[model samples]
Target: MTGPLITDWSAVSPYGIGRAAFEEGFRSGRTTSVPLENEDWLVGERADTEACLVPGFVIKEVLGKKGTRAMDRVTGLVVTTVGRLLDTTGGPLPSEDPDEDTALVLGTTHGSHKSMVDITRDTLTDEKPYYINTAHIPNAIGNASAGMCAIWYGLKGPNATIAAGRNSGIATLNYGRRLLATGRARTVLCGAAEEYTTDRSWLEWHTRGADETGTVLGEGCAMVQLRAPAADGRGDDDALAEVLGVSSGITGPDGVAAGLETVVGNALRRAGIGREEVWAVSASAPAGEAGRQELKALDALFGDLDPLTLGRPGQIGDTGAATSAFQVVATLTAAQDSARAAGRVAVLTSVDRDGALGCALLRMR
Candidate 1:
């Protein structure tokens, strides 16, 4: 059973815009985190003053003034990323003939907490109860970002948004593969995005509660284009990697290590691979005990192999739903240069504090 091939990809990351910038910053091994400025958005007291943000990413400034007056941060990141990817393919825009077989699937924890909170606040504080800004109403929904991506680019295929917390990336990839297998779509764009906002920051702070090592928030979007494998299983000449297998499960707080081990083992087995075959590994590595338990599970599975590990959280901070998508991108970036990496296997794993765990296997082309 050959898997779908990754034909093209793009990213709007904290490092900068486009895939090249992300690759350069990732290879340089420098952290993107910077001191937070006291902007109007950061309206209240906060414990953390540092974050990893997409540099100079204003919606209208990046995507132009038209049709962007009410765009939220997450929607802006997604639209910008998908546009960069379409540019590589020389695809038609919304004004031109659109590809009906090309679909989109995006993952997120929530759409835009800032937009939602602001809209609610206006209803409570404004002179009239119904004086809320209607322009922002669309951005308050969880599927708003994905919906805007479809309309902005004329993607008329199966459009959907998956909310799976931090494990959303792997879940999105799996869903895209199913769309290809079922003949619902010939091409699928799979990815995830997260936005940094005061509302999100405070929510995270309350969620972390007593954890001393608070995870710094980060914002970005990463997208990859997928197509069915060639008849001979070689896939496209420019294919970056082949999706081998994906597995996920829910484990309560006490069973994090055991649960992750089960999912990773299942993914490897489905891919017809052994632990020793993995050339590289990447993990979400969220801060605190959950992160430690995730590492424990991986160690129990691949401790002896000692493959190359790419750690993104320490550099990019906690990107939430985008974490696993960034992990996939990081693996692709590292495998691009090495001849030894060709035909090798890479494993990506993620665990959320609320008990979600997932693992994915990718075979380099």
Candidate 2:
């Protein structure tokens, strides 16, 4: 069950607005966090925690001011990221009338908590229950970002959104795989997005108990262009990586490590690759309790192999829904640049605190 080939990718992250920025940040190996502002803290001590945010993301500069009046942060992040992909694949915008078989499947933790909270608070605190801006109400839902991409880009094919917390990278990739495998689409723009809003930052700090020794909350969107592999079984010389297989699982209480082992083993088996063949491991286990459980799971699977391990949370911060996708990007970049990592098989695994685990096997092409 080989998955669709990941032909290209683009991102808008804390580092900057494209793959170059992300790669530069990763190469520098510098911590990209800033002290949480007074209002940015809702649960943790300001001195002990920090946040990774895209420093000056202006929608008008990225997409112009036409439809931004009612756009939410999630929508802006997605549209801009997708726009960059389009810039590389074709032009900055889709053709006046492009293929209708193209699809979009985006993953997220939750779509724009700021929009949801803002709309909800407006309805409660306003003079009237309906006094909130009705025009932007649609932005409050989780699927709004995906739907907005279709509307803005004129992608008139299957459009969907999946929520699987940090495991969303493989979740969205698997869903997009179905769309391509079932012949429902010729191309898929698949990715995950998370915005570093005040509410989102506060929630991560409060819920995850993130501190100096834990995952720092970050924000960004990472998307890849996927399509059926060539019949000749050949990829472009510049292809980032070839997807072998992707699998996901959900665990009960105290089953996180076991669940991760199951999914990773399944993905490797389906790909017909042995554990010894894996040359690198991209793990999305942020620091703290969850990170410890993830490490335990990896040890169970690859303790003997001892592949090169890569984790970018400390550099990119925990990107929430975008963490695993950025991990994929990080993995590919490492495979591309590092002599030790180049032209090797890599396994990317992700685990979320809410019981979801996912793994994707990739081979540098």
Candidate 2 residue 199 C-alpha distance from true site, Å? 1.2
Query: Distance from true position, residue 304, model 2, in Å?
Result: 2.6
TM-score of each: 0.95, 0.90
Q: How many residue pairs clash in all the candidates, one count each?
A: 0, 0
Error of 1 at 205 (Å): 1.1
Residue pairs in steric clash, candidate 1?
none
The list of candidate 2 runs beyond 4 A from truth reads 36-49, 88-95, 209-214, 340-343
Residue pairs clashing, model 2: none
Q: Please, what are the lDDT tens digits per residue for candidate 2 over residues 1-365? A: 44588888888988889988888887788887877664332443342346787767766666777778788887888988887887732223445765598899998988998888889989999999999998778988899998888877778779999898998887888888889999999889889999877678666657764432555678889999888877776555556777788898887665778888888888888788987778888889766766777888888888789888886543767788998888888887777776766556888889887778889888887
Which candidate comes out best when scored by lDDT? 1
